[model samples]
Target: MRKINYKDITNQQLIDVRTQHDYQAGHLKNSLNLNPGNFKTYATYYLDLNQPVIFIVGSEEEGHLEELSESANELGFNQKNGYLLIDEVPKEDLQTTETILAEDFLNKSDDFILLDVRHPDEITRPAPEKNLVNIPFEDLVNDYQSLDTSKQIFTLCGSGNRSTAAASFLESKGLNPKVIEGGMKAIQEIGK
Candidate 1:
């Protein structure tokens, strides 16, 4: 497999195979954080097999890079596109997306499009607002064009993982989407 230097990656989709806590601490802008446990499944759901994907692993754990590379190969990701060692990239080159907390989102519900990225069956509970648009993350790659690009989209999932992926996908498509930090679980807690 090829190894990529951080500065050379211009248009390739970046997938960070790191623990969620590490990812949330800091990650490349628009990079999708695929937790090791869900890497295979998330790759299947969000990745376009034809597009080039660059995997980013923490410099402290170079050992995990090979394992992540193997997992990507098994999931049909072309290994020739290569991996990136996160520490090699300058701190200024990395950035995090904006995330709205559940309570904060609820307060501004009228100003944003509430996008529920959960599966249809998983949405047994009704949304707090009537502006909810149900488009599961699995269908986003194909159905994103149907959404109104004019409005700001706030994405939510069962917890928060799927929404992060959804927001990254939306951003790639040039749509502004903010991930709801705590997702439905936070909303439920607020209701209680």
Candidate 2:
């Protein structure tokens, strides 16, 4: 197994092994779909070795970076370079929707913007009571200007996958956005 460093993966190409329900709920930018259950066939026929690949899943429930790293090695991907991560993990206390809702989101509709980071297909359908702005996870970086970076923002998706990535990117740019932990599912339950 070839050893690679995590810092080298600046292109952000990811391989998802979680369920389809998890993927459609939200995913990383430029990610290629691969179910871990069928990874051998998928990797044998579909994986592109030239591009740097990071293995990901919905959450640690899917196994942390250790599991992903091991799988990537078995699939003949660069073990040294591959990353293992839950699509949504809390970063500093502000990375989860639950944390935001408990302290900030419930009280600050006037001061913050609610951004939905799911695909257009999900956002255009019936949604929860929370006022939300639609910007798919994959498009967030490209269409970032469409969002007002100066304000405090709250981002969510169907399952919190895309929202986490969206929140992190926005934060890296100096915008303090809160991630809705479970994404739309949590929002819907809260509204009900």
lDDT winner among the candidates?
1
- Give Cα-based local distance difference scores for all models: 0.77, 0.56
lDDT of 2: 0.56
Instruction: Give the lowest summed-lDDT range of ten residues in model 1.
Output: 17-26
Expressed as tens digits, the lDDT of each residue in 49-98 for candidate 1 is: 77788888886556767677788778787536678888888988776656
Q: Candidate 2 at 154: error in angstroms?
A: 0.6
Q: Could you tell me which residue pairs clash in candidate 2? A: 3-80, 4-80, 4-81, 65-84, 97-180, 97-181
Every model's Cα RMSD, please? 2.6, 8.2
Error of 1 at 100 (Å): 1.2
- True-structure Cα RMSD, model 1: 2.6
Off by over 4 Å in 2: 5-99, 102-104, 124-131
TM-score of each: 0.83, 0.52
**Winner by TM-score:** 1
lDDT, candidate 1, at 71: 82
